[model samples]
Target: MDIKLDDLTGSKIAGLINEHLQGMALNSPQESIHALNLEQLRKPEITFWSAWEGNDLLGCGALKELDPYHGEIKSMRTAKEHLRKGVAKKLLQHIVEEAKKRGYQRLSLETGSMDAFEPARKLYASFGFEYCKPFSDYKEDPNSVFMTKELFKK
Candidate 1:
């Protein structure tokens, strides 16, 4: 799969992001849903990427700059038909590399704490993200699990 910078203007990515938000709603409480919509993902602070296999959209992820040295992982989702196919892992690796290239010192993320989000939590943990208190503007929510990893800490 090829990971490419995405501008978030394509209908295919929009539909996938909608699908992700819809799924998040079904799995988490309304207040704990932090997944960004297309407009938010298009913000100047966020860099979005899409993974494709030629003409097929496989997965996507984004890095949102919280500050000059800190970044947040956002909007990670794999196509429903491509679940368990390593598409997400590849996209995530790409995002992490991009974060390091940008000189970020840390990477953080917020995901659901419920059983429905088990796969996501596990995925993050495997990537070295450890549980932490909320970062950025996030508040503690029982439905949310906050995690972070030091990318280039001493």
Candidate 2:
């Protein structure tokens, strides 16, 4: 699979992001949905990536620079047909490595708290991300689950 920085203008990425938003809507209330839209993902602080296998788009993920030493994971989604094929895993690994390369000391993310999000929570846990309080501009919401991993030991 080839994973690289995406400009988010392609139809495949746009469709995938729309699917992601739709999935979030299905699983969570509108107010509880924190997933960024394409315009929001294009902000200067965010770096988006897409995974591809030849002509097929496998998955995508993004990293947002919250600060010089901290980053936030965003928009992690594996294409419906590509589920369970390690697409999300590979994208996540790439994001983490990129965060480390940027000299980030911490990497954090927020995901849904519903049963629909169990797999994502487990994936983050497997990466050594521990449950944490709301960081950055996020607030305490029962529908949200916040997690963080320390990239470098102090």
Candidate 3:
């Protein structure tokens, strides 16, 4: 699969992003939905990427710089047709490698704490991320699950 930076164009990546946002709206509360729309994900602070196999978009994810040494994972989504195919995991590993390349000491993320999010949590756990207190402007919310991983800079 080819993973590269992309714009907010009308493509399968954009469709997957919309699907992810809609999924969040359905499973998370109104105030707890931190997922970004295509326009918001196109901002300067965020870098978006889509993974594709030939003409098919497999998955996508983004990295948002919260500060010079800290970054947050955003917009992680795998296409419905490609679920359980390691798309999300590959995108996540790419994001982590990119963070290391940019000198980020840590990578953090916020996902749901509900059953709908267990698979996501498990995926994150496989990457060495652990539960942590909320960072950035986030506050305590029962529906929110915070996690972080320290980069080894290898």
Estimate, for each residue in 49-131, the C-alpha lDDT of model 3 and write its tens digit.
99999999888899999998999999999888999999999999999999999999999999999999999999999999999
Candidate 2 regions exceeding 4 Å error are: none
Instruction: Report the C-alpha lDDT of model 1 over 1-154, residue by residue, as the tens digit.
Output: 8899999999999999999999999998898899999998989999999999988999899999999899999999999999999998898888889899999999999999889889988988999999999999999899999999899974
Which lDDT tens digits does candidate 2 get at residues 1-154?
Answer: 9998999999999999999999999999999999999999999999999999998999999999999999999999999999999998899999999999999999999999999999999999999999999999999999999999999875
TM-score of each candidate structure, all chains considered together: 0.98, 0.99, 0.96
Top TM-score hit: 2
Better of 1 and 2 by lDDT: 2
TM-score of 2: 0.99
C-alpha positional error of residue 132 in candidate 3 after TM-score superposition, expressed in Å: 0.3
Which ten-residue region of model 3 has the weakest summed lDDT? 8-17
lDDT of 2: 0.97
Scored by CA lDDT, what does every candidate get?
0.93, 0.97, 0.93
